[model samples]
Target chain A: MAVINNKNGLRIEKADITLGFIPLTDCAPLVIAHEKGYFRNEGLNVTLSREASWAGIRDKVGLGILDGAQMLASIPVASRLGIGGPKIDMISAMVLDLNGNAITVNNDLYEHLYAIDPRSEFSPLIAAQALQCVIEENKRSKRPKLRFGVVYPCSTQSYELRYWLASAGIDPDRDIEIVVIPPPKMVTAMTDGDIHGFCVGEPWNTLAVQQQLGHVVATKYQLWNNSPEKVFAVSESWANENPVTHQAILRALLKACIWLDKKENRKTTAKMISQAPYIALPEETVALSLQGLSLKHHGQLPEKVEDFHVFHRYSANFPWLNHAEWFISQMYRWGQLTTPINIEETVAAVYKPALFRIAAAAIGLESPSIDRKTEGNLHEKNMLMKSQHIGPNQFLDGQVISVGGIIKYLEQQSLSKADIPALRLINIQKEA
Target chain B: MKVLLIDIDDTRANKLEPILAWTGIELIKLNNHNTDIYQLVGEMHPEIILVDTNSPNRDTLEHLAQLNKASPRTVIKLGNARSESINRLAADAGISIYAIDNIPTKLLQSLIDITLSYFYSIEHLRSEIQSLKPEIDARQVLNNAKKFITETYGLTEEQATDLLSKNANRQGRTITEVARQLVETGSFI
Candidate 1:
């Protein structure tokens, strides 16, 4: 492998590193970095290990067993706040990708939803309200509650699923059950009648739809456009100790993201990631997200979504502090966090946009100059402008998640004193 | 009465159900095999968890860690003999007792007793070590040994720690004992 000198004159602390990733289409950047010799060009040896679950990724990264990992966008924030897992002071300087997740419901649920509303537009609110009807019927009939699956308790899938449901007046806590099912087993679980629906990343969603086990109700793009999905995360201590290495990794990943965004390269990238060592799914299944084709539903016509997955376009790699705050607000809104936390401090400690800026600048990539932006206020007129701002990032309910808005939202929800036992059940672990 | 059995296939369940029944440990077997094991354990409030599988995966151990957080329970894993590193990983992931390979049904009860006693003693020692100064030096030595093993064998830090513990168990010694040997020799088998 050819080695290039550090052009930025920064000392590389560690040349050899191992990064962890769950087997999913969104882990493409890390795989592309290693396979395309991006890491080798910077004088680094990168080993990409396929992790079993998000929790395993969190634990291994937290314990310093692995240097860094492709983590759930909320994992670092939740870990820092000590909400769903151990407090590990994790940080993410760059986001891996955006909006590669979809909500998939089993065939039975899909039929029920379609029967309720056979509309062409895949509106999350409409689907959620139909789900509300199913939930009420189940309650009235004294049947077992409908169980839905998210990849992790502290994940974008969890928040998005909850947000979408709550928008339709369905109480996620009492109306149904939410469980964590690893992405790989989601289709099987849905087929086994273990879960009625799940919100997860591709190609699991695509795979389920293709297998005729489920249908896509809504993509994350429909719920919240270009929402932060997976992030490249490491412990804060790891970053402090290996600043140069971290920057180098970030630069390589940014280049990979750039390489991935080219429409012509999507086919090859899809084929590359579908190998057994990487995502291990069919190339066609992985290609569906990359080619930006309409996702096929069980009964409804395919929905054409162009921004299904954005890797480098519109400064998608930059870690936004506001995104972190939005997650914190969601955590509070859903009763995952019962105590008030300083959102500014948590964002400062976990979302390091300055580091991302340095890496982007070093690689001659233009990143968002500003570190924060108000979410849920994008219009088509300003969509193509090349500024630090990127959007179409609106919530289904049209509620803006600004700093003050989150504060007011949390206060209105009274999450600090909610004291819901079912909410607290998942967080039973003693602090380590 | 709160006992949870996970991944216990019908064959093992058939063999183990009678044994557990005789002991009056009402086993609440998990039927949903795809849900998060840790979250299920949290919801069920199982005081004791028994997992039977071919080998424990990273998900299993990670869930065990989560289970420990919600409520520390006596966990027993019965399966085929995995690599020493895997056994070590299982232990680190919070399985109190990891019994590799099948054992005669007659010895199962006695094994449980010994495992319970062993867990208590280790917990007692852990608390004592938490308050001692020498423990810090020992930890440093262990850390150095783990680093050495990781660099030399190209194993992950978790895997290296597992190897050390596995060696210690095989030699009928403690982790500190095996760590000292690795630290002194600067090599691990």
Candidate 2:
């Protein structure tokens, strides 16, 4: 497919296209790109469709029903590797945002956690230990296992929830029950006692806190600073067929990310996404993350945490292969990926950093030269370092889990019995 | 002996009972107004599950997927508008059949039998692919690819096979190459 140099002097193959996005605050970039005319400015006509779930987005994009989508960071990788469902080779040219998810628990659980440890640190370990105590008491009393909800099986929410719980010695699979619930229904599920807590993106977390049904226990920033969240993903075949259009989309989204990073424009963005056609949540609820204000917790004053929702800064939009590796490790650790996989090959195939570089260069936005980096390392000077452990990659257990370390951890952790059937299926397929 | 039929709107549910009466199969009507359909499916392990809705939303699809995972049962979904993505998801989630457009009362028994037979054949093919050992033959791969294409595009088997060969010829590649690509990528041209 040759790129046509149009009258506008822009190299584009397809202008009119449809993009899918779930109704979440992090979908701001896609909405702003459409509503704020960034897409039009880039000589593209983009229609944003609100999908009900991540599976819908994945399937629609894989089947070419939608050109692309705002997807969970792990989705493209999982889809490509056939982890959760069928294998659909998806590529992520740009990341949508970073660190907007938080874990929230019902008021009763929050009260129990507070009674165990009332420190203001919001340490994942302390909260997990308290949960352990609760689990033990429930076991003594013959209560049902606590159920936790996540948006999708192969999402960052599930990984973050598993990571937090695993670090505290709680077996996510054996000790508790984890279920998949849509983001909009998280609050109602928690109120109905269907789920004890949930890990999801805003403004559901904010809404839960606002409704006094639950309190924030840990933000993704605390778990892993500047963690990659959602991405603009498309099928690999689609990207190859319409290279120019793909680059144009990346360019438009880059401009939107830059515009969103501006401090003064955040309030406007929150308002814009709060409209009916977009996120359709209250303006105040959507604005909380953008404002970077303190979040409410049960039996405690609001806690201040900056960088709650990062759109562009810290090279957030760059699709790093290292992040993909981390997700792959999590998938293996959680038994989602039953068999061994080539981590580097799978990650490189899914994350198109070269396309991101081209789009960023077109807009004169400086992007990282390297595609891989060490995650969980937080520091001031080398925040965007590509390699050479520039900062602290510590988890709650004081262990800095790197790619190699995670592989070892997976080896040490036995695969749960529940995953045996899936593994057997894979084994059968491999034998054939 | 038993079939579970769930429809939130009583219109389609009422019409389904008369259609299944001739089969002598005991039909269990479930009030889909209840939100916890997944839990209900677990409680009542029916041989077959049927759902009718005006439009199948993500929630309904997700619940169906959950039911498929928790209990391996044949599921058939009937909706008004045809959605390629929904059909693909149904296939991935192990749903036997997803029929769009209004149901013709006269065709109910035949459709049910077709769905069950298709599901059994697919299951048999999966096991055959497994037992073949070490190398899945081209014919098996082609059969699976054709099945995927027919499901995704709502095409007949012959049409899907013709499309695969035509695309392969256009690309100057063999049918095996094209069929393998389709099976691996889960996509069709």
Candidate 3:
């Protein structure tokens, strides 16, 4: 690529570009980057296109129609593994945000669970156990399987929903039905009785609770503290051809994320993204969660969960290899991917920590020195007060996965269809 | 063979239905956004599905193809030779194609070619009419300007044309713009 230095003194390969984003609150980084002049600060002209669906975004990026996009964190990995959609080589150097999705059950389902066990309102585990009882009763009555909606087939929401369902011995595939619905239409689908519950990002979950149509059963934060939700991904070939341009975009997004993490700026961020060209929702609905209020129940004050949407704090922007492995492990556990491949090699190709380090360093920010870390090891004490570099990483089931222990982690998950021996044999061969 | 046309509006679907009728291809048009796509695809078992590239229903169709391995999957791996045409199919026609594995590649290619030509023809006529209207309107304005100049100033048609051209060149504007302004205001700025 020819390097042309702009007036800003950055050697940008391609300055005029178009990016795609779905109308979710986590699309904040890209929107803020464009709205706040961060992209322009880096001598780049960017257009943010509002996409109708994740599939459309994926295909456009694959076909080079879009320069890059805000994608579900699992999409790049799934795209590489050829799991749910077309096999396209995609990569991400930075994670946009973490832990902004929640699972909501319709009012009737919530009432049933509450009737079975009152503690279900306070505890996600208790709610799942109660749901087990409700499922049993529905089975005895021979009613059709309750349908649950997710944003995409190979999405973080899908895996989180399955992880929550499998917590109480409910087979997500056999015990209930799972369908894909776009985020914008989620609440309307629930109102029309097309789905009994759904797992999606805000402000759909907040909108559902506000309309009194559903109650939040569990949140992605509660399921896995500070898990990755959305990422900034581009085609691998695009990254190779425009390395400087990619880094420029990443640096701009990092600046946007740093600005988003500040408490005072969040209200304005919410109001800005709620305009007609972006999310196009009411400011209050979008502001509730962006301002760190988890509105899980109607007719009650929203709980203050300050880390509800972590844009930059706690090394959140770093694209850890272990996170990519977690997504791959989920794909195997759910039988979405039946083949066994080298997990380390695949993640190394898809999640470029080396690139993230470069971008983070350019802005004089501190990133994690290592690319992999043990999950489910941090407690509240380790991550409290915002003094630590990394935040609490705990799983609801309290399963700890070592750096190279993804196969072992997959072996422990219930309702998993993974072939451990096969996986182990292939990975060991690759290691040798 | 069963072919499902999803989210194609009435006008386009009407044009495609007849072209596909005589080829032994049964076309099923689904434009409703609220339909249970998974259930419909499962029962109908369409060998080929064509959906709008930007349709909100595309995600559900993707999920359906993923959940059922035997179902009609997206034609993603049409080899390096056909990828350019696939890009054209998406960028030009705004369509995404899905078909079962056993479908012949030649048949798929012909279907894509047919759809692309159909869209191009319609687009061609639409643009032609759009381009012609402004020219016709410009001619009417120029004639009106010339008649007013000849009747008011006692100048011949050639003199009026020369006068308008001189003013258009002096103002660095198109003749149509100067004529429209003259006809509207009875004088040029």
TM-score of candidate 2 against the unseen true structure: 0.73
Best by lDDT: 3
Interface RMSD of each: 6.4, 5.7, 1.0
For residue B3, what is the lDDT in candidate 1? 58
lDDT of 3 by residue, A133-204 (tens): 999999999999999999999999999999999999999999999999999999999999999999999999
TM-score for each model:
0.72, 0.73, 0.88
Ordering by TM-score: 3, 2, 1
**Residue A396 CA displacement from its true place in model 2, Å:** 3.5
Question: Which pairs clash (backbone N, Cα, C closer than 3 Å) in model 3?
Answer: none
Off by over 4 Å in 1: A1-5, A299-301, A381-389, A409-432, B1-189
lDDT by residue (tens digit), candidate 2, A28-141: 999988987878876788899887777667766776778999999999998888656546889998998888998999888888888978752467778888888888888899
lDDT (10s digit) by residue, model 3, range B22-50: 68799999988878898899899999998
**Which 10 successive residues of model 2 chain A have the least lDDT summed?**
A423-432
Candidate 2 docking class: incorrect
lDDT at B3 for candidate 3?
96
Of 1 and 2, the candidate ranking higher by lDDT: 1
TM-score of chain A of each: 0.92, 0.89, 0.97
Better of 1 and 3 by lDDT: 3
Q: Mind giving the per-residue lDDT tens digits that candidate 1 earns over A43-160?
A: 8989998876776677667666689999989989988886765567799999999999988888888788878886513767888888888888888899999999887777899888
Residue A71 C-alpha lDDT in model 3: 98
